[model samples]
Target: MSPVEEVLDFLIVGAGISGIGMAVHLTRDCPGKRYAILDRRDQLGGTWDLFRYPGIRSDSDMHTLGFSFAPWKHEKSIADAPAILEYLNSITDEYGLRPNMRFGLKVVSADWDSAAARWTVVTEDKDGKQGRVLTRFLFLGAGYYDYDEPYDANFPGRKDFKGQVIHPQFWPDNLDYQGKKVVVIGSGATAVTIVPAMAKSGAGHVTMLQRTPTWMVSRPAKDRFANTLRKFLPEKVAYAITRAKNIFLQDLTFKRARSAPDKVKDFLEKQLKEHLGPQYNAADFTPPYNPWEQRLCLVPDADFFEAIKAGQASIVTDHIEKFDKTGIQLKSGQHLDADIIVTATGLKLAMAGKIAVAVDGAPVDFSQHYYYRNCMFSNVPNLISVFGYVNASWTLRVDIVGEFVTRLVKQLDAIHAQVAIPVLAKEDEPEAEDIFADFSSGYFQRSKHILPRNAPSLPWRINQEYRKDRLDMRQAPLDDGILQFRRVRETVDA
Candidate 1:
């Protein structure tokens, strides 16, 4: 019953992959160091727990998806949702992580007390009981997928002619589409995945509606040679080869699209045409820019095409004008009838929603900050938001950050320092016009002004390249002007 034992050394928010990964690392490396993982859900695996949509799977292969220390032992590169969840559960059990987790505990806010040199966390349990925890440091492993569907298509409709209207994120458990016509709105990953599965389940008809075209690159879920190599050679070697190959192809296609214009894209369209046949046009599905600008949605084993070929699904390249009682009215003077309307219109980006830091008890407005190295927020003291690569497996970058964080924590202990904060100079902040012109979608754009900017941007500054990150995050001096450190606090027992 010691008060000090009650206070943990570190408080990690979210028990998902990142949170669980951080816990495993800290516990294994530091040993007996007090740390607790808080998650809002009743169970572990944030997205894996929340998303129960059909055909849900990882975009990247399992080789790079799993932790560096843990290799995914599966024959196929792309795995289904249940298998992924099981894999995560096994890790949780193997590491004995459940005991360290505070489930159904949602963190309302985190405030850093400068004088105490500690973080004060306020949490509300599922039963509405409020409790507080104090910790020496805080790490946010809360991922981007926390929020549900941002905008439910509230189209003008007659409530009188109702059939079920569902979003894939919150799909109905008793929803039966057998021999029923279905229309999935949006061309993103969610919609693409849903259409095929619905078709396979004996749905009479399924159609996907897209407002804008997206780059849909369909490939086999399993690569034979790579899988065989993984069996014979070491897992790491096989993973490295697969990762390198994917990276090379991604970069090559991106460079060709950006530098060589429509030539390469046209070639891709020709291939698409050959596969999709005469009635189906590829241009309706091709993207405006090069690949990797925005992440390309991965259809498992080109299942979307298979659905189309089987006459189970089709695509409508038009906007929905309004909703009738039974179906939707498109702007192109077309009426599409359906018994179920599934809106999979992508996600709304939120930048570090779980993190709310205050200095000396004043709330720090993170949106005004610039990102430094895309890891640490500018002018924010003792905080880092870990984001991964767009081209490769996200976990790869996360694992690197985990290692780096451990190293940094160890460094602070060695130096007798209490705080490590990112310090951004006024001169480093890019102008408004420059920022608006350059920044893209998702987390990057959401944190644009506050994040660190590279001069002569684009090809030079984009953090997609791993070597630059290694230089900035690993090789850079700790005492550099970018981050400031402060001394540890001592309390008198007199």
Candidate 2:
């Protein structure tokens, strides 16, 4: 084993919401533990910092999205990237977590040593300088999508286009599109956001061209109930109440969509009619799939519909034949001329932040293992990866997982166990199921082979139900029969 300066109790990768939340939990629950947060980016805010396209905002309400320990006092529940980043920064400063953060470091690989019961994590900085850190536990909060690459749809003859072709993931700051025709490809959240934003922000006309329509709903930017409650109650008290309310509503809506998709579809149709009125194009708005199959796009204040009604934006549903010199050629023989093309095509999902993981010199294939309680994997010792809920606010799962991790670490110390692993016997292995079977998102579907296998039941599966997961993860036995605990020989004194 290589000599290290100091061993960290927890080495958290990615200083995003998940990583920050975990650090805050460690500070409060595992106060004696030594931890450090490492992020590839120089700045903290993960998704919020990475994405800089116009109209970039939280699809989920801030009441639930914000950290449970921190109250989101913003007037708008659906906030932009700047506001979200500010909230995250405040949390970092308030918790005194800045000193423990190491930015501009990308984790390359992690190898666990059974005898030592520690992981040797390899990291590389921007200048290609390598560094190593020895940690007892490794937590991955690096998010699911690939940071270096966006999904490539590979539209034919993209090179032929003369106009500015851009992907929302990498938007250029100097590019000007005022009084110019804009075409946004894809019907996802990014596309919806860019269409309205470009339209409202001086684009002569903005057209959203999608191969297939996506489900969308509109609501007010600010939460009336939450804003009202803040006036009478304390900030934390109001946040808690609002958080609970939003979680319940989110769960209920998901359940209803799955149980009675037809009714939910009708409700969405009604909303579209109300928002777009005469401008409503059923063929362009109505999706062939059921609600919640893919994420339901949330448009704050009907801005998207208003843009279309105001003649600044339009929707074109057709397959792209190819890209031409001036614009895109559609299969319907329609040519949409554009000075700017924004490809909002979805992200490319990457598991474990594409970090090479090995256990005892053997490569670990995540697909072969079962997800143990959504936080840890089967047969993987001293590792926790936070993959949030698809249907609810991501931070809802983050808060519960944070609580569970703190509890697990405490139990390990109490039992004098140096290593804890979820061991699944060959015969006892449950039937394999897609972790995100319910979700039909392109990214989720594409990454099925790389993701860890899920089971039909609890503890072996990644439960989407936050209410159940919160209870199970928090109160469930730490020394469950599946998880094996052992004490390794002490190599160094703390």
The lowest-lDDT stretch of 10 consecutive residues in candidate 2 is 1-10
Model 2 over residues 361-454: C-alpha lDDT tens digits? Answer: 9999998989998899999999999999899889988899999888888888998887889999889999988888888898899888899999
Q: CA shift at 278, candidate 1, in angstroms? A: 2.7
**Tens digits of lDDT, candidate 1, 26-54:** 87776766889988889888777778877
Q: Roughly what TM-score does model 2 have, to 2 decimal places?
A: 0.98
Please list the residue runs of candidate 2 whose C-alpha ends up more than 4 Å from where it truly belongs after superposition.
Answer: 1-5
Q: Residue 374 of candidate 1: its Cα lDDT?
A: 52
RMSD of each: 3.5, 1.2
Error of 1 at 47 (Å): 1.1
The total number of steric clashes, by the backbone 3 Å criterion, in model 2 comes to 0
